[model samples]
Target: MLYIGLYLVAAGVGGIKGSLPTHGAEQFDESTPQGRIKRSTFFNYFVVCLSAGGLIATTFVVWIEDNKGWKWGFLISTMAMLLSIPVFLLGSGFYRNKIPNGSPFTTISKVLLAAIINSCSGKTTSNAVVNMATSPPSVSTQKSSDTKSKKGQEKTSENESLETQTQSFKFLNRAVNNTPVYTALKCTTKQVEEVKVVLKLFPIFASTIILNCCLAQLSTFSVQQAASMDTNLGSLKIPAASLPVFPIVIIMVVAPIYDHLIIPFAREITKRETGISHLQRIGTGLVLSVLAMAAAALVEVKRKNVAIKHDLVDSTKPLPITFFWIAIQYALLGSADLFTLAGMLEFFFTEAPSSMRSLATSLSWASLAIGYYLSSVIVSIVNEATSRGHHKGWLSGGNLNRYRLERFYWLLCVLGGVNFLNYLFWACRYKYRSTGSKK
Candidate 1:
């Protein structure tokens, strides 16, 4: 029953996270400059609003679980979940609905299969030559080709203006043939274009998983680290679980300042609609994640030293160090999240084809989810690699004081640094589809 309920909750959370943000963003018009600006603001506040709920959970809900009981915590969660239904329904009338054509996976699969089948025939058709061309064609050829390939040309107002986006993935352009090798393998220009957008965004999506891997530590090992520290605040004890409040508060405070003050100032200097480019914002977050890991390592070193000084290294008792020490990493990761998450949401949504915006935006959370899973895998791999011939693994020790946590943090820091370099390689080369973000 417990497992079932957990799975149910996960399903519900996934649905809400994927759908809600896309729906809110659809409310804003992205067709005009003002509308696009307003849409960007919506993504910012979306993070702020999520942080608000987190603020309550980390403080109020966490306190209840610490002092009162776990049952009360569950009860409060149930009530909140029940209450949110009506609140969401109340805004339905004013909401703009984006009706999906079908599952995006189907389109992706069709395009891939078409590209494969059409290319396998080994026919270098005129359409393939046109799409795979490295340089612009002569004026005579352009006019003649346009007349011949009238069907492939997008005449719709939305797709007509951006015909050049499909040029990057030339192989897939074969999928758009009028007379495909197989009838089922035929695709449209919009389909090939959308698939190319998804493929191009892949590297950026994978790069942020390492940052999420760092973030996963906050809930697991970071809390355990706090559990070994002094959690007292003016005679009022605080729970280690509630330590997340530090980051939550930071997000709530910093998000608004970035949107209101920081953005306007940036717009003045850059004269760009999006004050900071999405890739720049994501890169900033990646850099901070590297710093966060380094800070965590340093803090771990400081913590271990204090434990040894007090002769508490072999014991489980709380050391003289304050729980606020753990807040250093939390604060950094929080700020990283503020930049990366908002940037990713906007980058993925604005840059994606209109049909796939919801799916693209959902990739942000998918990266986070994969990161959480990856954290555990990393720990397991570390344990296996270090446990050699009767030597206990760095993180295998039951006592937090006895663990070589600093070494583990150092490993993450190094990985994050490498990931940032990888991100720079791709981000520098990435072409922005949006006019507001054109570099």
Candidate 2:
């Protein structure tokens, strides 16, 4: 029953996280600088609201579960979810809901299939039918059935083109042959370009997965490390689970400052609406994750050293080190999340084709889900490989104090560094759909 309920909750959250950001971001005008800046603000507050909810869950709901009962915790959580429905509905009249286009994935699949099938139909590939590569006909004009007058209008529209056909993804360009033996296999230049945009964004998506893998450590081993330390703050005894409150608080505080103060100053310096590009913001977060893992390693080393000094290596008692030491990593990772999560959300929404904005934005959450699973896989593999020859793996010991967590953190640090370099390569090569910079 508990597993069933958990699955239901996961379904609810998946629906909410994937749609809400795209819905909120699309409210503003995409054609203007002010609208773009305001959209950025929308994504920022979306993250802030999410953090606020997490804070409540970690502090209030957790307290209820611990001191009152699991029943009370469940009740409070259900009530909160119920209350949110009406609140969301109240904004319906004002919201800018996007009209549904046909499924984006279906279109993407059609383009790829058409590309593969028409790759070698050389008779159809000609400069004679139309120079679809250099001067593509608009989709609306093309759909009207090419009359002589409509053909003239298409030529006129081509002269006043907003975006030329890009040279990259040349293989997919075969999908857009000027003439084709099978009409069903013919793809429009717009369709081919949209697919190109999605393919280009994929590397950026893959890069963030490793950063989130670093974040997974905070919930798993970081909490365990905190539990082994002094959790007392003056007169109050804090639970190790409550350690997330530190990062939550940091997120809530930093988000507003970044939106209002930092962004405006960046605008002044860069002479652009987005003071820092989305990729640059995401890169900042990746750099911070590397720092976070490095900090976690050093802190673990210090904690282990203290345990050894106090002769508490094998003791079940808390180490003399403060749980606050773990907060340093939390704070760093929290800041990283603020940058990457919000930046990726806005970047995907802004850069994706209008029809695929929602689908592209969902990749932000997908990366997070993959990262967590990767973290577990990495842990298992590390244990299996290191525990060879009947030796204790770095993470295999029964005792948390005996575990070489410092070594584990350093491994993550190195992985994060390599991932950041990978991100830089993709980010530099990526051309913004709006700006059309090939580099």
Candidate 3:
């Protein structure tokens, strides 16, 4: 227990130090490859570590035995925090002495983070305008010849005017694509490159809702698994209330380690200027989530075997299954924090027109709301269908016991698979953009 506390403290300090760059403390641009990669790497590592740790802590809390296990988790967390004091000091050597007062990403992180887990309707609007402006002209030009004679000369002038109009519209579209609506327009290659980025980011944004839906199931359904599993800590009977500790401890500790170490190391190795884009990280995270669900489903199968051996037909009684299954779920789900939420944070801030940062952050939350609705709807449909049969429905609470839980797991698996495929399709088609003048 003491070792765990120490380890968590050390990791947490490291993570917080690394995350300072994004704490509204300093400003960085995504226009340059170096800048974007650097920001993306740090952000991704931070989120992944945080999520993984939180899950571990959650598992511990749920599985821990005793009346005061929750209090012990807190004690360890506090000590780990105290240990982080030196980490903060060490970080000062790498980060600037003072935090940056303002930047584009500061207020917008919330929106992107929210969008990662919620059904967002507004984020598409900004991209839509940019898309419209960049799309090719619908009208075709007619061929005309200029005459050296008087009549021919007049025709020549008309043709020149029409040519100029077409060019003007083309330039206008390019200009809109390159720069933010709020910024002064200049035609530059760098600006154009930024607009082109918008194209790359489209798929990631499209997947936002699906990711949200999957994540929403984590707390509600996954914890139920822990509750049903038995602990083998001798006479000490553990309750589910203390399971959240493991994930929380993991998050609080791992957050700093990845922030300071893994991110910087990866950036150095990859030679990516901006590190990795938020979209890439988020995509990776979505994949990890799918793996986590798969792990959970496997655990369910294991639990069934244990039940058979014990001759226990009661669904609610704790089975003699190992706790590692819960731990695996926590670890994998926690890792997602690095990619999904972090990517959303950076994406929303950078993609949004500067004025709507608040709105952008809020858009991410909409996915969570939508996910809840979707989960409920799916569960209701399944329950209705399976009522006459022995199958379990969506969101069914423990009545059918293992069978019902198994059914829910299968449902999530199917949903997550379909969602991931759709996300990939859109991700491939989307673009990334920056606010600047084109050369």
Which candidate ranks first by lDDT, i.e. highest?
1
Cα-based TM-score, every candidate: 0.89, 0.89, 0.57
**Candidate 1, 348-426: lDDT as tens digits:** 9878887888899999999999999999999999999999998889999678887889999999999999999999999
Off by over 4 Å in 1: 63-72, 122-158, 161-167
Q: lDDT scores for all predictions?
A: 0.86, 0.85, 0.54
Q: How many residue pairs clash in each candidate?
A: 0, 0, 83
lDDT of 3 by residue, 1-439 (tens): 9699778866765554334434521344444545555565555555555555556555644345244676776776667667867976776666533334454343333323333322222221122233222334444422222213544543343333222312211322333222233233222322233233333444455566665555555566666667667655578765555555555555556656666676667668765443455566677778877777777778777776677778764656777775657877667666664456666766665664433333344444455467667766776787787766654444454533445666566667677778788887876655453321110
Q: Model 3, stretches more than 4 Å misplaced?
A: 1-203, 232-237, 389-397, 400-402, 435-439
The alpha-carbon lDDT assigned to residue 21 of candidate 1 equals: 81
TM-score for candidate 1: 0.89
lDDT of 2: 0.85
* lDDT string, candidate 2, 135-198, tens digits: 5558875676365563355434433331345678887777776666678767676777788888
What clash pairs does model 1 have?
Answer: none
